[model samples]
Target: MDAHLRELRYFVAAAEESTVTAAAARLFVSQPALSKQLRALERRLGFDLFDRGPRGLALTSQGSALLPVAREVLALWDRGYAEARAAAHPHQLVVGMQTAVGRDLQRPAVERFRARFPSWTVSLRLVGWDDPTAGLADGTSDVAFVWLPTAADLATRVLISEPRWVALPTAHPLADRAEIPFELLLDEPFVALPSAAGPLRDFWLAVADRPRPPVIAAEATAADEVLELVTAGVGIALLAEGNTDLYQRPGLTCRPVPNLPPAQLAVACRPDEPRKEVHHFITCVQP
Candidate 1:
């Protein structure tokens, strides 16, 4: 049986928002109308897509399984639409990165893209944590070096898995240790990302299973702030192990966490507005 693309789109939106009312607002439809369409789609598919409960709508196993397929279909369509738009008019491709991207693993790929599209000018923008996606939402940059768990709407290609390391003040008791346990950090006051970061803030806080709130001594938007705060004894911060040398202070030291997983570094772009230059850049970065 052929599935309606609109239905799949609505279902995915609802799943991502986790509330029909929110999904309705996002899709610019009335709640009752959206609900009716969802019901109709479920019947057509012969499966219950979500578990409606007091907390909100939770995806069933079937719905979770369908999510990636839906995203892939949408992504391919979006890429085609972007390619068409780029073909009609020439435009600059602005790339943003949090650090000096000269040493980036994708440099070789970028060189190849330049050889193929010599007429396109690729400009690089230095971005801070203030806007991790480097203005992808507002079109400041066509694409960016971003961390994952970003705005769910952006499509990305992961570049590296540089794991997290904790920076401790030299005077602190744990500074002498070669490594620290993740559990030890549970009790310490931590430096946090800006509140505007939303889900990103929570991810940096490592709050997935935190029962009680944490003590936040400071908020950092860049490596300098992270070092300044940690050195002044304001709070400790977790950062990529590779960045340890970048932010070292006279009174600061870095050590790995025994059990925490690595953080993903990636190149991100708006899936809905992929530019040809961005597509070529993504192609260069892809392994």
Candidate 2:
């Protein structure tokens, strides 16, 4: 009925306090002004919101029904306002990721970005690994830290290229071995990323040319979950060797897999609407 959130807030505060004096004190408005606002709101709704009682105030049926609805509207408006404010004010560079992007890479990149763009700030946004492009596909990030073979629409600059490694429970039979062949891991049940990850999921599974499907023990969206599943002996998983040391843990051990194709870590962004800041950040990380 074209009611503003400010009116809804006044109505909700009045309803909760059950008296104009208390509502005015809570809202920092005069008692007469609060009473006038409530009267206007009721007139807009074509209803009497409250009845004046000797002791305090009592809601009519319409006011009782509208109390929660008004509170909800006020809460939603507050959240939307905060989001718009952040969007309007920031000179931020949001980099999205799905895994443990090592500080080894991040520190260097950010240091260079600061030197190049002193007035800017950097933000790291962790997203679910289900989407292979991280948040770049949907424009949630100015750029993304993702594995190779992301959505074809994105342009990328490589960061690190490293061989795949397998993380296994320390107590597993094969954990004592120094290295393993890609063929050996075929029969082992493995933890996998979500199906929406597309070809990147296949790369981790070493399934580019394999005829048989992987026996997925569990699905995970982040590196920690994969390591946890392995530590619990749920199954083994593949990860880039560069991250093997970063994610090292007592219960899990990672070993090189020599036969699998190496993965490329890259900073990716949409080529069509590339931001100048994102381009500068990419140049900082490029070899």
Candidate 3:
């Protein structure tokens, strides 16, 4: 019986970490979940992968033998997947974005890209905020329009740098102001991005600008959800200035926060990306 790629991945992680707890942490899954997958893989192979111990797990002889093979298989699969994407979709460049890049950037850039590569096409994928890289990490996007401070492995060029603004319900007292002081809104409950968003979440929460941690009213995974939450009076949220016009609704009001550092929107791609078309798209988006 053939083991699944996911099972092999789990096995490799478990073998390397030497403990289900460590493996789960490394994989961003629960211990029980990782343990269950490992047991399932063992059952499929009709052998135990690890010998349980009080201190930690020890790989069985079979497990140790299989570890390197599994690692090689996973590496080969990654290479094959990347190759397939390039070969199968050479003319289509996928651009992932978390929100509407409404600074009149998308249209002109895509037009320029199309003009440059007459045979090529662009696919704009709207990804959620949970993936701050906008699908670059997983190879779903050839290039992404992502907020600044993304993964270090990816390269970025800042296309838009604008002041961060606050979104509030129309009825909120702060909504009436033309501009709100950063400190004045510091105490209000804030709608935050998912913790999976990492540094991007902290940026939106103004974590560095605050005296203490923000009081998170709720977590939102998308720009629309954040706007909806603010409109429903769940909590206020911070946004890039370019998004204000795109997300504007009757019940939501946006006010600039002059003291806060501006949010930067960039075109990001894997630094090692082989496709010249991807780099061309980045150049098209550059200010």
Candidate 4:
């Protein structure tokens, strides 16, 4: 039986953390899901990986011996995958984004990038809000347009800073206001981002400014769903001002939240990224 990379990763995480709960958090997966994968891996290998006790998990003799080998395999695979992607897609750059980067940034930046690197092609990948790094953490994106308060390990530069705004159904009483005070909307049911989004979700919900947790009408993993829910009067959502213009629709209206701090849009890449193309793309997006 062959051990898949994902299984190895699960095993490695479990071994290092010595607790399934901690390992699950580190891997951004549910504890039960991680436990299931670890069990499946043990079944395939026909050996016990860990000695589960009340205190926590301890690696078995077989697991201890396999740990180093698994780490090495993962490291080698990551390096090889990067090298192969560069070789096969030498002229392409993948940019991951969660929402429409409207403020006239994306088109102009892409144009500038094309002019600078005439032989290169750009691929825009729309990632769900659940992955706050916008695919950067998974190595699927060469660069990303992400909201502020992202993972600390990634390098980021602010591209735009704008006031936070609220998206409400047109029929809502507050929709007619020129601008709504943050305090006025405190008790309203709000559309929230998935819990997987971590602090990014808190930022959108204005958790810091709230007296208590805002009522969650529903959760959405994408900007479109948030807007759709708002249109249906399911809940209101907080968004950046630029998005107000970009996502304007007949049944939806957006207004500024004067008391809230501004939101920032930034270009992020792995801090140690070696690719010159990634840096070049960052340059193109600079205001």
Candidate 5:
């Protein structure tokens, strides 16, 4: 059974990444090699683990049942490993996030964090937007910063709550307006977050039961992509206030939308796993 630990690691990576090529890149192995290992693992277990579809990998029943058990085993192993190495080396903190944190917020925060924990190193991982928790629930990040309305299971700390705005092409009729009401933008098509973002997606769409309905022109998981689509006339979207600074392009214009409820930016972590390191980092970023 111990021999399968490596297989478990491979399986978990493949499952989390949802594609052989992506999992291989993360694991630092060739794509073909990763595919072979996955196939072998399936044969050894005598069942299919993933359903390869147009939408990418979806776990089979057996895979879903085995996932939590495998995570438990990995967590136990990691704890033991950390204990064994704590005396010999400095600790490392891995932070996961979906959006661009920007130099204004991250620079001072990281410098202060390093000064506070002089011996520790930090790794900022850009997790995809598919999981609203931004890797916190999966244990990939010690802590994560993401838009609010994440999974209820994870703990959260609100960093910033700002009014929403709309981004559209300069060619848009309302581009010259100083401020636009939320009602006016509802009937227009807009770029939206992927469905996997859960409530975060719904919140950004501002889908109230008004007569107007959301016409999603395209789905985007990153800010730059959404902005690009916006400028290309794909659609307009409601954006957080901070996005005005994060995305500044010649073809785009951002205007405050006075009526929509604001979005909150927050730091999230698993409630079951809290540490001083995470607490300190939170302090450094707090407004």
Candidate 6:
């Protein structure tokens, strides 16, 4: 077998990042060098690893299958390498959330994590992109608040499920209507998230039943960008009911939609590499 751990590491990084450039940046290597090594690995393995798209790279079925094994090997290696440091150094737990979760579930959870692990550093990170785990696959974050159907195969726990709502221009015709119907907003232009956002972008675009491709007037990676686009009449956006207050912007108004399932928020981590700190934080969440 020509299998090399270095090749596995590079392949996993490229797969998770879904782009050679991103993987290179994360791995601290030149893009061409990363590409060269990836091609060599593919040649050695005798299978294609990624499908290069205009937006970025996407994992092939074979690539997806290899990802978990690669992760397990890396985690085992980390455990062995970290054993000495873990004993002498203060343990630190990094947690990531898609948004600033300020509800009762999150507040007490933080407090409890701090009280329980006084010697450990607990850091809460607000993540903006669809990959809210912020490299959790590579062991960067111990836990993350992410949307369901994220990455297709990560282990997750649902935190909140709230109905989806639309943010429209204040002067929109449907502004007077208390609740806008999905049919009414079908033809309207929408602000879309980056393609890398995966299922999350599709959810926000209401892509399930549209007859024609949605008109993407702008691309937003954060809540503020969504509101800015909506206020400027560039496009409308869909969000969870709880986020209506958060994305509130001048000249933009949020209204309920008649029919659509609410977005589901989740806390996710690698299934195989369970950590004590991750459980402590998740257990603290009341609901």
Task: Provide the RMSD of all predictions against the true structure, rounded to 1 decimal.
Answer: 8.1, 15.0, 5.3, 4.7, 5.7, 5.0
Q: Pick the candidate with the highest lDDT.
A: 4
User: TM-score for model 1?
Assistant: 0.65
User: lDDT per residue, candidate 1, 55-167, as tens digits?
Assistant: 88999999999888987776565556546544655566777776544335557766887888887777778766656676564456677877767765788888778777888
TM-score of each predicted structure versus truth: 0.65, 0.68, 0.78, 0.79, 0.70, 0.73
Residue-wise C-alpha lDDT for candidate 2, range 1-287, written one tens digit per residue = 79987788788767767888767754668999998998998888999989988877899999899888887776556445534544774577888887878847777888999888888888899987675777665456777888987644688888888988999999988888899877778889999876556577778888884669888999787789889999999999999998888898888999998867788998887665435767888887744
Best by TM-score: 4
Query: How many residue-pair clashes does candidate 6 contain?
Result: 2
CA lDDT of every candidate: 0.75, 0.80, 0.86, 0.88, 0.79, 0.76
Comparison by lDDT, 4 against 6, better one: 4
lDDT of 4 by residue, 39-103 (tens): 88888899999999998799999999999999889867765675578678998889999999977
Q: Write the per-residue lDDT of candidate 3 for residues 142-256, one digit (tens) a residue.
A: 8898998764468888887899999999999988899999999888999998756767888999999999889999988899999999999999999988788898898999999
Of the candidates numbered 3 and 5, which has the greater lDDT value? Answer: 3
lDDT assessment of candidate 5: 0.79
lDDT of 5 by residue, 166-219 (tens): 999999999999999877786899898875676788788888634666898998
Off by over 4 Å in 3: 1-80
Candidate 1 vs candidate 6: the lDDT winner is 6
Question: Model 3: clashing residue pairs?
Answer: none
List residue ranges in candidate 4 displaced over 4 A: 1-4, 7-35, 38-80
Model 3 scores a C-alpha lDDT of: 0.86
What is the TM-score (0 to 1) of candidate 6? 0.73
Runs of candidate 5 exceeding 4 Å displacement: 1-90, 209-212
